[model samples]
Target: MSMINTEVSDFSVQAYVDDTFKEITKAQLLGKWNVFFFYPADFTFVCPTELEDLQDHYEQLKEIGCEIYAISCDTEYVHKAWHDHSEAIAKVTYPMIGDPTHQLARAFQVLIEADGVAERGTFIIDPDGKIVSYEVSSGSVGRNAEELLRKVEACQFVRKHGSEVCPANWKPGSKTLRPGIDLVGKL
Candidate 1:
């Protein structure tokens, strides 16, 4: 089933963030854009690269009113340990959510039940708590943060301008397609 426009369900999970441990809930995600980034496991090869990539662009995402949450099936302690041990992970400043119970993973439909991990998934949710866009990649592949930033920018632009739609490879300040007006001549 398509996850588009699906409201995020109520959930509270432990997260390691800002050099501390805290509880993050669905309620907190409301009133702001959120990126629920799920990875296979903590301390893995590709996961850190992706997280670090996101970290590099973290400020840009926040400047546009978006918050990123990196999640994995590993426990919070493991996440903290990885943060303490790895140089790449040490640079991540966003919330590292611990989905040990697989509640969040199952809700997002990215859980790998057989392996006890989540697929590499990226979900962009609006301030209303509904998912606007999502993508799941193969376990062996890593994603690009620059692309994720572009996706968030596009989502925000569409949310602010309901009548317009972003075209392929759309970036901020670029021309957008107005379905009724722009398509009148073009087919």
Candidate 2:
């Protein structure tokens, strides 16, 4: 089944952020847009690059009222160690959630049970805690943060203008379609 518009389940986990360990809860995610980025593990290839890419766009995401949470099955200690050691990961100012118990990985349905790791998953959640958009990629592929920012903008735009829909490659200020019988078969 599609997870679109589905409410996110309640969860509490430890996260490493800004040289401190913090507890994050589902309740905290409410009342604000959220991006839940799930990856395989810590101190591994590809993960740091993807994380740093997201960090590069963090300011723009925050300006759009979105909070980023990068999650993995690794422990909080491991997350902290990687943050301290890796130059790429060190650039991340967002929260790095540790899903050691796999509650989050399982909830997001990105867990690889055999490997005890998460896939490359990105979920865009609305302020009401419902999932607005999501993408899951193979471990070998990396995601683009700019594309994610565009998606968030599209979601926000669609939410505000319920009658219009974003078209392919739609960027902010670009034309959006207003679906109607007159528009049918016209594209």
Candidate 3:
């Protein structure tokens, strides 16, 4: 089994922050809500559009105390080059993590062994380093940043108000179901 609920496992990786590189690990991301987005190789199709969308929403995400990290098998150098050259990448302000060792991908169960790339995987890890939400998509499908925002809101709400669970298509200020016998079979 994978370590979904465990603290950032014993893995270290480097990330490209605009023009420079920085070493990062699970420990460094602790005490914050982490959105670990795993994509395919850099300079590929579909990935840039999705990344740009996330970039556009970075400030909104930050307002909710969430940190975004885009990861791929490419090295930090490659990430920097792509960011420097691609117009779609210019908007991204978050770190582009380099998972050349595939340890992070493997831990998340998104690594494609034959192609040496990761599927589209997004994991929402809470401050405790336990994964709260996870989504994996095929290469052809992109992600929705708006939906992710809603999820973040839901997670934050649940964390603050224990014993309440968000129902389907739940939004902020929406009613949450409390677990009890009286609420059984009311759906």
Number of clashes recorded per candidate: 0, 0, 0
Please give, for residues 34-147, the per-residue lDDT of candidate 3 as tens digits: 899999989999999999999988898999999999999999999999999999997788999999889898888899999999999999889988888888999999999989
Question: Which portions of model 2 show Cα errors greater than 4 Å?
Answer: 181-187
Q: What is the TM-score of candidate 3?
A: 0.93
Strongest candidate by TM-score: 1
Q: What overall lDDT, based on C-alpha atoms, would model 2 receive against the true structure?
A: 0.95
In terms of lDDT, which candidate is strongest? 1
User: Sorted by TM-score, highest first, which candidate order results?
Assistant: 1, 2, 3
Scored by CA lDDT, what does every candidate get? 0.96, 0.95, 0.89
| Per-model TM-score on C-alpha atoms | 0.98, 0.97, 0.93
* Pairs in steric clash, model 1: none
Q: Ten residues in a row with the worst lDDT in model 3?
A: 1-10
Cα error, residue 102 of model 1, in Å, equals 0.3
Q: lDDT per residue, candidate 1, 24-89, as tens digits?
A: 999999999999999999888999999999999999999999999999999888999999999999
Candidate 1 local Cα displacement, residue 184, angstroms: 1.4
